[model samples]
Target: MSGKAGTETMFRFTCPACEMSPIVDAVIRADMLANGCYLCGTQVSESAFREVCEE
Candidate 1:
């Protein structure tokens, strides 16, 4: 993917504390989402957000 198409590959990181999801400007690898929070210093992953969204 390139140009506009590459933009779609970007993912947003949501803060677990404030529930503020920010669209990260940089590209995030699939594995990186399994770690900790980049915003509110919480330990979270993509699955965590999915769980929150489900509730």
Candidate 2:
């Protein structure tokens, strides 16, 4: 994780709340730790979103 308070990377994944719909604006650490949804500002599932990152 970036040590700074306001640093992030853009992650695209499926929305877990909306029936796995593809989402294109999640933010995790550069190391793939869970952050928040850049679209809706929700930090729901970091690990699940991280799994889809390799795609």
Candidate 3:
């Protein structure tokens, strides 16, 4: 088995409008990714997502 089999990087997102806690396991794959926060219905920007520890 390969040693690097499970080294997927995750991202955390926080809603700017609601100031909610980091969003768990946020997967973003675009340079211009934009979405809405599920909890507070706020528009999420690319800058809001941050890199998290690899698992």
Candidate 4:
């Protein structure tokens, strides 16, 4: 998927609680990534994994 220049494509994952999708701020440089939920601290998308490791 293509996004606006300078702004990276953000993927929203379902939140464990409330089930509301949230966009991740972490940049996705790799094909696969994973991260925890920013709101409920639940496991998020794999794309965020790279960001979590970078931090």
Candidate 5:
């Protein structure tokens, strides 16, 4: 067994418009990436999405 198992960081994206939670688990891949809520269309950054989800 490797100690590095399950050490990967995960990102949880939440839609601000419809409140669709757990949207995507692509944090590191999301860095410098821009995308909007598929459910509605609220444009937001990965970091911004994270902050909103935390609240």
Candidate 6:
């Protein structure tokens, strides 16, 4: 097998409901749309997640 590997850029965001500052460090934009906040289970929206750079 090739030594090269693929990497998906990870994202970070806080839970607005639970107020968990940066609840995760390995989430992607798509994850937010497909799932809820991992900590509070709040319905996730695109606006809810902000790139770590925003901090």
Give candidate 2 misplaced runs (Cα > 4 Å).
Answer: 1-12, 17-34, 50-55
Assess the local accuracy of residue 24 in candidate 3 as a C-alpha lDDT between 0 and 100. 58
Candidates in descending TM-score order: 3, 6, 5, 1, 4, 2
Query: How do the residues 1-55 of candidate 1 rate in per-residue lDDT, one tens digit apiece?
Result: 3435333444556666768775553334243355555555566666543222211
The lDDT of each candidate is: 0.50, 0.45, 0.62, 0.46, 0.53, 0.61
Output the worst ten-in-a-row residue range by lDDT, candidate 5.
Answer: 46-55
Candidates in order, TM-scores: namely 0.42, 0.31, 0.60, 0.39, 0.48, 0.52
Evaluated at residue 37, the lDDT of candidate 3 is: 75
After superposition on all CA atoms, what RMSD does each candidate show versus the true structure? Answer: 7.1, 8.7, 3.8, 9.2, 5.6, 5.5
Residue-wise lDDT of candidate 2 within 1-55, one digit each (tens)?
Answer: 5466643444556555444445344333332235544445455565545433332
How well is each residue in 1-55 modelled by candidate 3, as lDDT tens digits? 5677656667676667888755455344232144477666676677777878754
Model 4 spans > 4 angstroms off: 1-5, 25-35, 47-55
Off by over 4 Å in 3: 26-35
Pairs with steric clashes in candidate 4? 33-46, 33-47, 33-49, 34-46, 34-48, 34-49
- Which is the leading candidate under lDDT? 3
Comparing 4 and 6 by TM-score, which wins?
6
Minimum summed lDDT over a 10-residue window in model 6 is located at 1-10
Which residue segments of model 5 deviate by more than 4 Å?
5-7, 27-33, 51-55
Backbone clash tally for model 6? 0
Per model, state how many residue pairs clash: 0, 0, 0, 6, 0, 0
Write down the worst ten-residue block by lDDT for model 4.
46-55
Taking the tens digit of each residue's C-alpha lDDT, what string does model 5 give over 1-55? Answer: 5455555455566655677666355553364245466556677665544532322
Q: Quote the lDDT for 12 in model 2.
A: 51
Candidate 4, residues 1-55: lDDT per residue as tens digits?
6544675555555555557654545353222234355555555556333222111
